[model samples]
Target chain A: MSEVATPTQHAALAARVSDACRSAGMVGAPYPGAVAALDTLGYPTTRQERWRYTRVTRLLDVSPTAAAPHTAPPAVVSGLDALRFTFVAGQFVGGDTLDEGANGCFVGPVSVALARYPERLEAWSHSDFATKEWFAALQAAAPQDGVCILVPAGHKLERPVLAHHHMPAGVHVAQPRHLIHIGDNASAEAVLWSDTTAQSEGMMNAAITAAIGDGAHLSLEVVQDEPGTVHHMGHHHFTQGSNSKLTVRTATACAHWLRNDLHILQDGTHADSTFHGCYLPNGQQFVDHHTRIDHAHPDGQSDELYKGLAADKSTAVFNGKIMVHKDAQRIEAYQRNSNLLLGEQAAMYAKPELEIYADDVRCSHGCTTGQFDKEALFYLRSRGMTETAANNLLVQAFLAEVLDGFRPEIRDYVHSVYARRLGWS
Target chain B: MLKIDNLHARIGDTEILKGLSLELGAGEVHAIMGPNGSGKSTLASILAGRDDYEVTEGSITFDGVDLLELDATERAVAGIFLAFQYPVEIPGVSNINFLRTALNSIREQREEAPLSGKDFLAKVKACAQLVELDGKLRDRSVNEGFSGGEKKRNEVFQMAMLEPKLAVLDETDSGLDIDALRIVAHGVNSMRGADRSFLVITHYQRLLDHIVPDFVHVLAGGRIVHSGGKELALELEEKGYDWIVDAQPTEQA
Candidate 1:
């Protein structure tokens, strides 16, 4: 791979990428910096260390294009008693009224903020913390509308901020970017969901970045339950400050092909991060997850657990890596990937890697791939449960270990989604 | 009432129960004592409709219905129960949930409405006392992390709840101490009625000392070669199964 490109080709690519940025109304002219970097490094392929197990080029081969802004499609929305922000094709749609307690909170489209507060947009537009993911670069070039959440210092939001991204049919590509900045000692939770009823094959490039200040706590839940005709690519990056806690939980289902990249940077001492992910793929669907946790400072801890259940000719890939730098002594990091294969033709691949430069660090990584236990199935069947009931019960039990860790409302939502996926309801 | 006429069963190609026949009245308890590989447990499994056992010949009727035609659950609903020697442990499903599902399934088969949660809980608590199982154990997963005695007691508790017409104890005494055996026997005995029957299968006669079957049959080479009163169990325990097989007279050619 060479970091060189002709001037003509660079100019053409830069123009197309910049047009997307202008259409989305992103503030600041930081397009050239990202273009130069992409021309140098190019899009990451399967040959890269971090992308060895996940082949993202298959989905990214489609040229970057701007997704047209459209009205939010009607959906069977439940659990809407909390705060809600509806984003249509990366543009913020109208939202319901908020409570008096959320007066200082900032909600709605990112472009609104870019036009309203140019200085804040300039400062937070291009974060240096994002991974060099190709889709992330694409999102940065043509940033669409997304939610911008800001909780002031020492304030606690009683309700979660729910960001809903909707893409209509014929919109082949969407790049939605969300920026969340939490002040010191503030605590909040956010649930991000991407759903589309598009009959055509569309693509979504989503990027979310969160910064946790000192002694703040934030829980991020990302859910992707798009139709099978769509392709989804999501990137999540976060920085945990000193004494702050950040937890990211993701549940993805029903996509022709989907890729998710999560990066957590622990830059402050005594900060903690936890990443949990679950995916269920079926009907020729392919889902891949790649996660990285960087312990940049000493006395930081990170835990990662990603599990998958595949059936009906589906394939899933999980690659989780934890890096403990030389200065990250006394770091406690653990990573695990477990998969359950139901059908004979279904496949799952898992690779958990740990790189520790400090001798006193406690880091462990493990991976497992197998099918349901025959003995357990037989036991349940013998107890008067039908074969279908027995299998569903076991699968529910296996998935509950992960779902139980979520909030009650979110947990129930995930449970209903899983039940529908498993055809148990 | 039950009847097995010239029943033949095999696992793969090798036949285990060859021409085994037995009969039980409604209120009687029959003990089938055999050595290892003598097909005592096979009979219990075959009667309970375990899928692995293939029936090669003959037929069995339970209360005038074809027993062999029913699946495991159907047979269970038809009032046939098997107390597994080594009960399976389901980790996440609570014991109460498992029992209620099983009980309701059987009730549904009989065209009866399922019990309400409060009514079911009361019945379960009563049965739990009969089986001497703790209230805490009932809340845990089905047999998960339970002691050997606790698992057997849970099995008896399930039996008491289902209230089957014919109960098969398949080596239920294999791993029990004297106290567990007594509690398990009491659980079984409390379920006895004029309309219910029992088939006690054991390698040793220790369980028979408590269950006290009306008939004791010596099972040798897959067939019940000798049948006698309750004393037959004591005789076999003292003389061993080899003597029973040796005592069979060879046919004159």
Candidate 2:
């Protein structure tokens, strides 16, 4: 059994994390609630309901000696025609920086955007999760350089932005905070991809904060393909405006121990949101996805779907909460989660929480956990496919609904990652 | 092409096939008419290498090789096919893709090159036409939401594509209508050749009228008790199975 951390140990670890974040440099001044939130939330404990399945104590051992030298890794999805920005250890390394003076679009790092036009980012750069969640507070208090995408009103960014963050070999903490703001009637697309080297070991506490203005559109795809022994905590928060459309697709193709907290608040009427995610964890790895969407206004719509598989004693957890406010009538919300347990010892936890205060709302949720259909396996085998090929085909079929929502390039890349990790390629 | 001698098998503690024996030569069609629970489907499953049943005692030889040694995939690679009574509905996997994978897998195991796309599609077109299967069914998920007759036609279509040396039709005409039954029987008859053999397991004589067998055997109490030519089906259909079943030797049990 692993030893548990006491209150004093937790305090000491918090102090050490603070020192590490300070050494990694801060992004401008700390946000309004960062200091107070750090003192109040402190460190997350498994005793808390939200942290029950995740053991944050395992991350207390991360102690940094010194930051690794910055070097840009090979670009991912190179053939795709997109503006790419690379960051290593929470610092910008190389990429095309499209910075049109102040009022125009700015596609670069958050630190640069803060230094150049802090007023434009000051309103939406900080998320409410910073005050309510411990990890989010830690990230906001000492945030580092990450992707910053801003599109002015009535303008659409022609090319998608690919923000790639790499964690080099180290025993340090990297808190990279990404921010995006779309003006009224503007639109843009972006991809947040983070990967780590095999030898790297540390903590990646990242946050993505975005705000869509009225009549604006934004679509983002997030990919987490970390292979090293890194513990990742992601706090993603988005707010949609009236008549705005937001679509987010996340593919956790590979991870050791990762938890993603995603929240989207529909702050205006007729705002539409579609979010889908997929994950496959094998061996002794662990993955968790917690998502919530608030239908605060009438005529809003949201659709959520997540599917995954746990193999070889791995554990996966999914929690989705849909909240409808009192006056948010005529809203339709749907949530579904499906999981496959490939190994006898593998575990899966799924919960769907719906709090509908409105009388005229259409809300439904379904969660199912089952193993592969033995009859299907037999049918495939009787047709001459080996066990491996048959299993690969079934897994692909199971995840197609969620994975197909992503762009073709990203979909294939994520599929290859899963196939390689499971040794099905 | 296939031979079974005193094959005893069971599921869990209950014995299903007790000392069952049969033999089939190349270029011949043998129909095994049996009453309910006579282990006809059990024989088909064991021959296809389904692991649900255990062969307690006996030996099965396919083309001079120990058939029991091969797994389900290996059995298919060795030229054996079982048209299921209830074809599985596999969503998200198109029939074309499933057939391509199966065909390539068999070829790979047999040390042969995979069929080219042109040749494979041509074969699919010909085989589908043989069963009157349209392009829509060929491209849809494997038997997903298919009608009863469509599912049976799909089974025959798969048999035509695989072209197995020993084809076992386990109640292929169970849910099929007369026209569908005729189409399926025609698909099966067109594939018969000098190098191929078939084991047709059925209950009624209507299917036999469409695809006449060279010989007929009555399976009762998990063993073959009576044997005759195609005319036996007519006699049995007119007389019913009780005449042959009640006449079996009680000492055999």
Candidate 3:
């Protein structure tokens, strides 16, 4: 795909893109709507509220580069026991088998779905809400070989599905898309790990859309621990159906600059959602998390808590907004953001907003930014723990409240990754 | 087991304990009763190796080792324990875990094997009963949201577990009621033996009544100017530090 363009340049780029799609024989009968949506909303700039804290222009100012074709796949340790799908850059590499004991569980790359269900592809090829996001736009315009996870109705998978995205070092831009659809009354747990060891500086723009049917339960954990020289932008959309529950735990560490935008829609009555995150940014890294919980129906509940530990001249930002519509009465929503600064040069900005139009709703938000407790540190040190050991224990304890909520396997992986990022064993 | 000779300490440039001297033998319990600004806590802190208090001119020897040369934890491992007047609250670390780590650290310093989990739990349970601390409190974060009496009891509980040779009880009885004080005193009394000593620093003589000191000294103007048998505690309670201060200059002259 060509580089993103300004408004004046957008029209020509869209025309060229449409003609290219037609010439490549990739356009189907339903491609008009998706293409129109992509054309109208090119990319978001600093003007957009959700993209305010993150500077998209700085990331896209450089020339675009694609990932190398044949890099070695990421090394996966055994005993994961979950259905595994590996994606390199934006292309699917391969996968292992799903255990027969997993009870009708299926796992495969997005190419498998593209070959089988051509129509569902046309409907989801573009995102209407995130079309303006520059990375989202680029991801939409680019071709990707991502992952598609489907759980049949009323099927309960014994093991979680593990998807790993490994980006090799280089100044390449990757756009990977993931679509997860859980049928009615189905239950599953999924863990997505994004990692990089490449010495090259690059950016990764990833998008994930999940739809949970009525009475389904989905547990999702996303860990972002890419190289310190890389920039990452991720967008996630979750739609919860009636009487369903969606639990999401996200942890981001060691990115030069990372922006995660999470949007959750409660479409069914009595639906529930939980969003938990922990981010530790050190050195000159910057991490920003923007989350939105939209209570579109009555009798729904949502809770969000995100904690950050920043050190060594790093900066972090957290913006959480919970919206309860007028008709969405009996909605209980709470949001909290807490941060600890390890170094004097480190800083954090947190803003928790509640926009509720319903009279009978219970909504509250709290934000705190401060340093680690000196008394606690002294207490630990006085008990014979070294200063470094005390600080590590305190940081781990602070993050354990969030990490302990993750599935056991993912929790261990996240713990190892965070330990490596913090340079602690 | 512990000796303080002409101990003069200062916080910043202002001297707190000026020329204070005392000696404690093994199995002896000494109570130092004084007024609020008499620097009783300063003596305790100085012995515990608290960094804020600088020993301007003093000599402290514990078990024949120079106490001033050791850091806090080193002092702790050398059998010096100070039940802090105001114990710090450490959040997120359970009390049992903190105690275990502290105990193991000291043991490691001595090149002793660490206590096994089963043995540690039994010891903790036995010590909890001795200090009247509920077993449930062991699972909670260290001293977080603990009541004042509970904090005092927990201090004694730690003292029992560590079994320091020279235990300095710095105002451990200040914030406790009669019942709590009895439990704490009982815990302390149980640990008394020929191989250990106690330095009970307090403002009131009421705590001395329960702990029963071998000797009671009157601390006036940062120095222990009066030393007598346990009767001196009753005398100070009756006469107060004013008479002692008033009579000091004349006695010196």
**Candidate topping lDDT:** 2
Candidate 2 residue B87 C-alpha distance from true site, Å = 0.9
Model 3 C-alpha lDDT per residue in residues A1-425, reported as the tens digit of each score? 12334775544443443333233222123233444556566565556666555665555444334435545475554466777888876667778644222344455666676665555444434444445454565556554556677676898877788888887766555566787778789988888878887474666778888888899999998988787467788888898899999999998855788999898999889899999999988888899999999998999999899998988898899999898988899989988898999889997878887888889998888898888987566556555554555676677677777888976666677667667667765
Q: Which regions of candidate 2 deviate over 4 angstroms?
A: A1-5, B251-253
Candidates sorted on DockQ, descending? 2, 1, 3
In terms of TM-score, the best-performing candidate is: 2
lDDT of 1: 0.78
What CAPRI grade goes to candidate 2? Answer: high
lDDT of 2 at B118: 100
- Per-residue CA lDDT of candidate 1, range B1-253, in tens? 8999999999999889988999999989999998899899889889877788899998999999999988877788788888888888876678887787777767876889999999999999899999789999999988889999999999899888888889998999988999999999998887888999999999998898999999999888888899999999999889898887988776346
Which lDDT value does model 1 have at A182?
A: 80
Per-candidate RMSD, Å = 3.8, 1.7, 4.6
TM-score of each: 0.90, 0.97, 0.88
Alpha-carbon shift of residue B147 in model 1 (angstroms): 1.2
RMSD of model 3 against the true structure: 4.6
Which runs of model 3 end up more than 4 angstroms from their true locations? A1-49, A61-66, A69-79, A97-105, A119-129, A198-200, A412-425, B1-15, B53-69, B109-111, B249-253
Tens digit per residue, CA lDDT, model 3, B155-182: 9999888888889999998889999999
